[model samples]
Target: MRWINILLGLAVAGILGFYGIRELLADPVYFLELFLGGLVRGSIYALIALGYTMVYGIIQLINFAHGEIYMIGAMTALIVASVLGLWGWHSAVIAILAVVFAVVYSCAYGFTVEKIAYKPLRTAPRLSALISAIGMSLFLQNYVMLAQTPEFQPFESLIPDFAFWEPYAHIITSVELAIIITTVVVMILLGMLIKFTKIGKAMRATAQDKIMSSLVGINVNNVISTTFVVGSATAAIGGVLIACHVGQINFFIGFLAGLKAFIAAVLGGIGSVPGAVLGSLVLGISESFFTGYFWSEYEDVFAFTILVIILIFRPSGILGKHETQKV
Candidate 1:
């Protein structure tokens, strides 16, 4: 199976490379611009994918409200920055701080959601748990609509414009650069925490088997809650970056982003961290290329089409493992 995956990957890469070479020959500058744009876009997707993968790893359940959590994070940051009267450099600092605060708040919300909605249903049927997730998602979305205005509002400018180094090509905006840098830093820190920390070990143990982990004296509930917190925090960061990039937000901001990030998670392999990153990059780059070379109308189609093909050929996902049930 691994060999099959390797071969398939090579084939796909070869096809893409061939087309890419043709495009480069036709218009090198344009190709470079598209590639950079894709990377920036992929950073946002990767940030959101972190949340989905983390929650799925620990609980084997998708937290559908994650997107809403992200939406809340952006709103929280925006509100906080506005309250602080932050603009330019000060505004940028406030925005970053606000995002950090939002992450903390979102983490708390995630922990609460797990305790209130998921923990009680842990021993229940899987379908019941799934329904609960859906209900929680709807509740969060509606809660925002009721508590906050549904209309789109512009985000306050936080960072001053920096001079562009690329005179011929202006592919990388300051917001795009910030998104890429922030995503990389967060991912690196997370990777380190998971790889070299005691809590990380506990998380891995709990993910493998909760009952066994509990029996072994691990605080299974705490680990589970921590997992949710981590996932939600990452999602919150993603939301902030996305809002800053687009310069607007609304009550339903999370719906489409969440769906896309979910697709990215599945495409990369749900349980694998690196898979999520790779999947996001592939999805982002593909979408950008299609939109750049073809038409914007086909952007969404291109992403979903790739997803369908991936599912048809590799149901377990590109880097996902297939679990065999013992009957």
Candidate 2:
């Protein structure tokens, strides 16, 4: 089965390469533009998917409320930016402050949610936790709607266009460049944290076995809460970047984005960090190419179709290992 999956993957790659080469030959500029656009989209998806994958790695729960955490991040940024704008603060300063507040608030919300909704249900049935997650999601959505109007709010781009980047501006804007760079940096830092830090080591051990980890000196609860905080921080960054890119946001924005990121996580292998990033890039690039070459209206159709195909062919995902339990 593993060999079959490999061969199938190779075949799919070959076919994609053939068409990609042909498209590039037909229109080099357009092809590169679409590819870059896909990278930007993929970067955003990867940020959110990282949060999904990490939390799942630690607790094996989907944490549906994560999307709301992301929404709160964006909303928090909007509010900060708006107030700063009114005060005539520097654009760079406003951007930095907004991001800081977003991350802080989102992290707080994530920790609180884990304690209130998930921690208490730790030993309960998985379905109970999942239902609680859904309820929490709905609660956050309505709470945000009531707190901040349901109407779409305009968001100004905080990323500044560099004068030196004028030549390449046509290929990709400053915002897109920032998103890609930020994702790369964040990924590298996360990799280092997981590989070197003490908390990172604890997270790894806990993921392997909760009881054994607890028996050994590691604080399982602390590790779990830390996981939520880290995931929320990454999702908050994604939220701010995406809000700046889209120029407008509403209370419901996170629902669709979160759903797409979840699909990306599953496509990449939900519990694997690298798998999440790879899957997001693949999904984003595929969506970009499909929308550019085929039908823009059917972009969502294409994404979900890809997810269905992946699910049918590789239930464990591209990088996920199939578990075998001893009877």
Q: Pick the candidate with the highest TM-score.
A: 2
RMSD of each: 2.6, 1.5
Q: What lDDT tens digits, residue by residue, belong to model 1 across residues 102-126?
A: 8888888888888889999988987
What TM-score would you give candidate 2 relative to the actual structure? 0.96
The regions of model 2 sitting more than 4 angstroms off are 1-11, 325-327
Residue range 255-326, candidate 2, lDDT tens digits: 988988988999998899999999999899999999999999998888889889988888778798876665
After superposing candidate 1 on the true structure, give the runs of residues whose Cα lies further than 4 Å from its correct spot: 1-14, 86-89, 163-169
Tell me the lDDT of candidate 1: 0.84
Candidate 1 residue pairs that clash: none
Worst 10 residues of 1 by lDDT: 160-169
C-alpha TM-score for every candidate = 0.92, 0.96
